[model samples]
Target: MKRRTKKLLLNWRIILLTVFLIGSVVTLAVRPLTFGIDISGGVALVAQTEHPVDADTMQLVVDSLQKRLNTLGLRDITVEAQGDQIVLVKVANVTTAEEADAIKNVIESQGVFYMEFDGVIFGTGQDVEYVGIYQIKPDNTWSVPFRISKSAAEKFAELAKGKTGWPVDMFLDPPVNSLLVVPDSVYNLMNSSEFNAQVPEAPTLLQRITKAFNITVVAYANQTADELADMAEGREKIVLVDLNQGLQSELENMNVTVRLVQRGPGESDHALIIRTLGLYGPYSVGEGLATGQPQQDVQITGTASDRLTAEQEARQIYTVLKSGSLPVKLNVVGMEFISPRLGENFKYQALLAGIGALIAVFAIVYFHYRNWKIAIPVASTSFFEAIIILGFAALIQWNLDLPSIAGIIAAIGTGVDQQIVITDELLGGTKETRITRRSNVLKRMGRAFFVIFASAATTIVAMSFLLIYFVGTLKGFAFTTILGVVIGILVTRPAYAEIAKYLLGED
Candidate 1:
């Protein structure tokens, strides 16, 4: 082949590679993926434990939770221990109240293992038992397992008429504890005569079940079993109890007796007993238990969603309760749901902002290069980088929230900077000394790589911290930024360099 022809072939080869890279990005952009809060949201919970838990132990707990979240198929999830008693978790794409609640439940859940035989208690509470420490799903749901006593499992199953899995009613106890309930059908079959005699028309199955399985939850700060029993006098209450030394001390020192009161005639009344089992503090026990004394103490604030789904969410809460009390009890210091209007407006602003930034970059590159040959490649590379990022996001089903959008914009800038370097080096050289020019261009590219690498590393570090220390928007920005920088470095930069070199006949 002629020398010119040989050079042309080499150039075409480089062009082909760049095209392939760009094409792949295009394909990905058309179909992007995203992650959920469990996958990508930051969750920091400061639980007030009845006892002091060291940092190492807290880290262990967080690590366990992170594993659970990973099991759920979430990527980029981080779990860490903050201070002596706080566990911090950060994930991406947890944008809604429902998602946040779901993540919280998973982080807080204490899972237990149980085996049931027939409808009677057969073994001791600790036999062949495990608890769920954490569990996670790709869609951002996590469940943790812990050990439980075999006897407790049997008792719970007996109470639940041989139904065993996750005990819905045992959230107040350690995750390993069991709570059982007789189903409505069994109640109807067993109490038909009395039920019929009391009400000739008899209520529906649901009503009967509700009446038969009535339960109430209460929270007590510090009190012995005797004190709790005294408070429950004149009331038919199913008492869910937790004992910790710290809670006991707090109550005693404060001269406080906490009780939860529910007024209504029902099949069963529920009360929560918070006491110190040891010298530490009161560990939380009981699901759906009220906090404080009747008309006093800290109340379980916030209205719950209607039944069904709310109950399911409550089951998640129960899972956390089962896990055990947090290292420190955290009061809901701030609880504000993102309003729909605000979310919409924020999304709009983010989209517009990203578009504006991209257009500005494109204009600057086009005008600065002053040649369509150079500007085209830079612009194409920028566009290709975005497609790839978006495609990956869509393929992963990553939620394209506001912060993530910003990450995409930042990636665009990074891509542009790299492209500018490639264009400068390529255009400054000639075809007569192609090899020397190519060497110089590669050297320039290396310097750009160093800068890009450093920037990406710094961004990753910042994101990691935000992901661990903060929640909500800050976390979103961190996640998106990290992802964008990663994509820019790995996919976009090299492809643009190749394109620039090929265009300049320097390949």
Candidate 2:
């Protein structure tokens, strides 16, 4: 080779060498290889709704679920829709069976309500203007005040006339005294005749007086504004209350039941309004149920099972039923669980098979090129592509299942083919002039790039659909395949082409 050609080759070699060194460092430092759930056993649940659910709706649910799972600090969690009606959830590093069950329970409890209070003021000696409790924190700490409507302020003053400085409990539900606010004056209220007359009947009278106090309040239970608006028309005003722990225990243990006296034509069939206080709330009404029916006793049919797993599952079922039903019903028509032992065995076999295929391809390229110089670059580029793909998989925490392995193998084959195309263009030199020759090589490579880009685009589209519409291992395959093809086209293939041009004295 001429000195100039040697210089060019040296320069190109240095560039390739630098890329190889940096790629090696990145590969070693990053060590991106993801472990799938199959190797690390985790929980998998398949839920199906009753109605047909579209992808958009399912995606929303999955996004909400992802947020909840993240809040719980769970790792390697995957939630996706399998079909139109079914959703699949997989979580890794689950410490206990109860954790899995709790996840299921949370998913079942789709309605989440959060509230915050603004401010509270004590009742004056004259009258209480408005009574309400404000939440001070996310944990439900509250401040309460004795409030009376402007119209009823006079009656409040009469009831509290001589009882100034007396402490009155602000009941959130029953037995839950949120706070106690006392009037400023006591002597003026104690000397009044109204104080003595109401002293004996104070408790009962106080209850009646408090009941008449009207306060403006805002409440939300995760129902959308549109849903609330639709339900608000012709809906009778109802008071909802949150119960304290003591009140919840009392209600749970009591034999109290609720019955409706009448049913309205517009009422839902599943509605069952209760007057009794329960664990989470007072005067709880079952959602999606009809209203205005004759009142009947309600027996808490739930029983604690001896087995914790069974009890937890039951609670999940109850939550799902209580929350509105799913838009689409799903049936787990098929499920397959591969044991860790099997996974290990398959992995070993897959490793051997991949090595064998790679060796065979490298040997064929060496014979076809008849030049060790060309074969080395081709083999190195192919190996580099595979390593980079795996490194990325590990870095991004992608699950590497059998299907993902297959994708990497396919990417390697495609990469080798691309390298061969570059080699052929460099060797042919069919153009009459030197510039024409160079232009021809570039045009050929450009066409090759277009074909590769188009192929990658199609694969991405297909994989995206699979990821969006399917679940489990298939999604793993699609994800890895897309990643591999994108990286091979954008990075490895271009680098290989540059190396080939310098080797063939085209530059």
Candidate 3:
């Protein structure tokens, strides 16, 4: 018995399982698995492309969006293509409206940049070489310098020859309104007097922007402009046209805008037209700055009330300018926010479900076998299999969403079934076939593994399809399931067979 125990302990299968078990525990202790939005409480948005795109193009868009989100330091984000035209984005740990909006902008930008004069395109965002902070006469206001291509510069010069001081509008994804969509950090930076001093031509730079939105204030004696040129953007222009002059000035002091108006809100149809920005109208530039033939250098300026605000605003704009644009235009069709507290509740529930599954599987297996020797090892292997799967996920930094939790449960079920097959093959033979030689036991175990291997292979194949073809939230489920099966077959199952053989040999 002592020799047998020593041999079993020294078995290669046992040694491998032991190593993985230890490593799994250590990994869990050191770097725990990262939770997804469903578990950590964040936001999930579904966007539909403005026009239909092929699957490959959709995939490219998704990949590009993922890259953009990562640059924002948001590591826990999933950008997947759903069908051919819908994109799904999940951002973990973002609870604020401001954060959600920032992500939305990154996902929806069509990236079709253009600079036009009097409705004629002369340049696009592509013409701009770089967008960065420009120290124009330091200690005064700062400006954002856009270095354009020589061709763009010459074209602008030619256009400006006769139309000097005429508005030369710069646009992103032309025909879309330009409202200077900036992040909160950047909006604060542009409010500074120092920054505004440098770009004196941009009168609308310091307008009160709340949560990266345009807020236009009108005097107490209410009336709307003949046509707020920049009103033709993504959605209807939401102007604060009812406020008094004093409040308007206060908001402007904080870098907000309050202007005088002479007409009422205008016709209802006009309101709808502004909502869609004519769907395909030339986008109006804010504060319509006049341009000289800027020889490859263009400065954009905005006012920030303080220094930190100016810096943050500049950083935000810099990121937008640096990142590549989206391929197709998209509109936010759905958005849902999950609070952290609710996510915490989900974590607890998942834990309880997993524990309950383990207990239930063990009870059933023990009752079926009526032997601790067989039941204990089988149950132990199942438990260790889960740890291995979780460890792998953590090591890879995979986000643990609700679907992933469900996958873990499915894998546990399959593992228990496989273990039962192994035990039955080893112990249920008749006297003529049972109490056999070590060679015979090896043959029986091989037969059991054959069945296990086939089942595992089929499962993996099915999951592969889901992972490849269905690439949205379902990906989490398929990924965890495959990981569980591979670990079970390669790592845990072999160890279980070895332990069963040792115990059965003794009997």
Candidate 4:
């Protein structure tokens, strides 16, 4: 036993698992498992591009969506790219179907950016080549510079050759072929002075929205369901402020997309426009830029009350300019909402179920072995397998849903079966002696390892397909399952082999 303990300690396989176990414990302590909507309660959305995109473009899509929401003061969201064309978004603390619908609209509305000079389209998002770093002056003013393509710059110069000091308007993610339906109260608020005061030198809110954006703003009270539904005949989307079941049903029957926009107290007209229309600025054409010089460099300048505000302003514009120029568009492929109360109940049930499964595993393994040394090691290996799998998830911040938990259990069960193989191989049945020859024991361990590797490879291959082809909950399942199989093959199985060999009275 003393010699066997030394051999076990000196084993390279044992050392590998021990190191991983310690690292996994540290990882868990630092970053715990991030639970999915099914467990922690929120919204899960899958958005897919119209056509497949490269890895870089897919990442840009994710970043663009994240920044767009962050600009709207939504920070508790995760955007992840799946495959080459799909994106997964998880938003926390969302409970209502209305909020989910609003979010879905926002993600789907990434549109082309256009800069117009006197109502003529001079440049679009396609013209932008690069966005420079944001700069802050000694004062609390910030600027974000960008460069356009040579052709686009030349075209802009021709459009504004002598039109100095003109307001060259910038519009991003504009609502094309869309309508806004609002109640009398909200419509009156939009017509108020405070609302129009948000935009400098701009006309009335109603006039500017109608003229500049071509969006028909109709008071729902003024139009009957038949009239509204007829008006929406050629429209792509209808943004409704207050919920009206009759109009919604009519529009739905027409196969039109109707989205809800919540009206909050103290909502400014400019903010409402930004939310509904995505207009950015009315940048003044300087003498230099408007002199027909074909200039490529341009900057967006603004003043903020403090350094923090200035930084925020500059960063937001920088992020938008960098990411919003991507030409691809995403459509909502799937959506799921889990209420907080239901998620909590599911979480408790998962915990209880995991514990019960673990207990049963130990009992079955102990009954089969009838040896404390073998049984203890087998059960402990399964337990450690779970910890290490969770640790990997925590390290990368993977969201664990029901499917992920099931994958973990399946991996652990496979681990126990493999461990039993190693034990039986070492013992060589009842006909064999306790102290088998060293060379024979080595051969048996090699065979056991080969079997373990083969099993793990098959599992990993099947899971890799699922991980690449699927999005949302299934990705979580594939990821955790693959990680478990890999850890078992590389760390736990070989380590268990070493321990079992030592226990069989081999040096």
lDDT of each: 0.47, 0.50, 0.65, 0.76
Steric clash count of candidate 3 = 26
Candidates 1 and 4: which is better by TM-score? 4
Q: How many pairs of residues collide in model 2? A: 34
Q: Which model scores highest in TM-score?
A: 3
lDDT per residue (tens digit) for residues 222-299 in model 1:
445555445545444322332343533443354433321112122232111111100011112123222211111111
Clashes of each: 95, 34, 26, 0
lDDT of 4 by residue, 386-423 (tens): 99998888887777889999899888888988898888
TM-score of 3: 0.61
Higher-TM-score candidate of 2 and 4: 4
lDDT of 3: 0.65
Q: Which residues of candidate 3, in runs, are more than 4 Å off?
A: 111-124, 128-327, 430-433
**TM-scores of the models, in the order given:** 0.48, 0.51, 0.61, 0.58
The order of the candidates by TM-score, greatest first, is 3, 4, 2, 1
Model 1 regions more than 4 Å off: 1-115, 118-331, 429-474
Compared with the true structure, what per-residue lDDT tens digits does model 2 show for residues 1-507?
A: 586556655665446545754775586585645566666556677766567677766765665555445434356778877666677877754545556666776566543311101112222212322223222333332222233335333333333344423323221111122111112122122223232221343432123222323321223344433433333333332222321233323322442211112322243212211111111111112221123222222111223334454444333323322222234333443333445666677778878877886787779988886777788888888777777777667666677878888888877887787677667766763333332376877887787787778877887898899776666787777777787787777777777777777676665
The per-residue C-alpha lDDT of model 4 at residue 111 equals 51
